[model samples]
Target: MITRILLAVDDSPAAMASARHAIELAACLGARLHVVTVVPDHSLSNLVTRMGSHPGVHERRDQAAEAILDHVVRLARASEVEADAHLLEGDAARRILAEARSMHADLIVVGRSEGLDRSTTAHILEFAGQPVLVVPPEVR
Candidate 1:
């Protein structure tokens, strides 16, 4: 009885594969899909600035997040799933957990990283109270 599903995605190819799976699953189960993209907080980015990237980097990140969410939501809808998108600002894992709790999601779906880039998925699996599905990367 999956009523709500939360999917976390980024610009990575793995995330795109995860998004596709989520959309199909949501449509199959008649569940509402909630897509989210978390951008780094401006203050945090400022503190961790390296190579003089300058301030307000989060603004560009926000725009990118919005675009990602928009694309995901559109795909979900096309798959015949009721869907919504969210653009969050903060630590990626933290924001995802918060959204899951707030939305009362029955499950959380994320992309499986190939090597050492799965921090967010690791954090979610460690801290989330709900079930999680880690979609594998698409084979090329």
Candidate 2:
């Protein structure tokens, strides 16, 4: 029985697919869904200096996270599963792994780039200490 699930979501088709799949699996297994969205803290436009291009970048990222969370919530509700969403800041892989450990997640679902072949898949496979379900973009 999967009691808790961590769905790593981002602004990508593959992530959306992963979220949907996680919701379905969680609902079927009577598991609670936890959506984690991470935004890079030091991206190009988010230099955090006077010359940064957009001052509202963080706000925009937050809004995007909120929107994505809302969508996940709506999906989970439709599936009759309890769901919680969170906005985090950090590197993608590290944040996902840390959240899984912190929240005691039974499974971690992530969206994988289709272009990455076996090598990348192996690399990701080695990173997760828990079961990881990597959904490709086509599924999203």
Best by TM-score: 1
Tens digit per residue, CA lDDT, model 1, 31-136: 9999998877677667656547566666667788899999999898888899999888888899999999999999999999766568778999999989999998
Residue lDDT tens for model 2, 1-140:
57999988877788888888898899889999999887777564457635755588778778988899889889998999999899888666677788888998888888775553334345546877778898877721
Misplaced by over 4 Å in model 1 are 44-56, 114-116
lDDT of each: 0.89, 0.80
C-alpha lDDT (0 to 100) for residue 64 of candidate 2: 84
TM-score on alpha carbons, each prediction: 0.88, 0.85
Best by lDDT: 1
> What TM-score does candidate 1 reach?
0.88
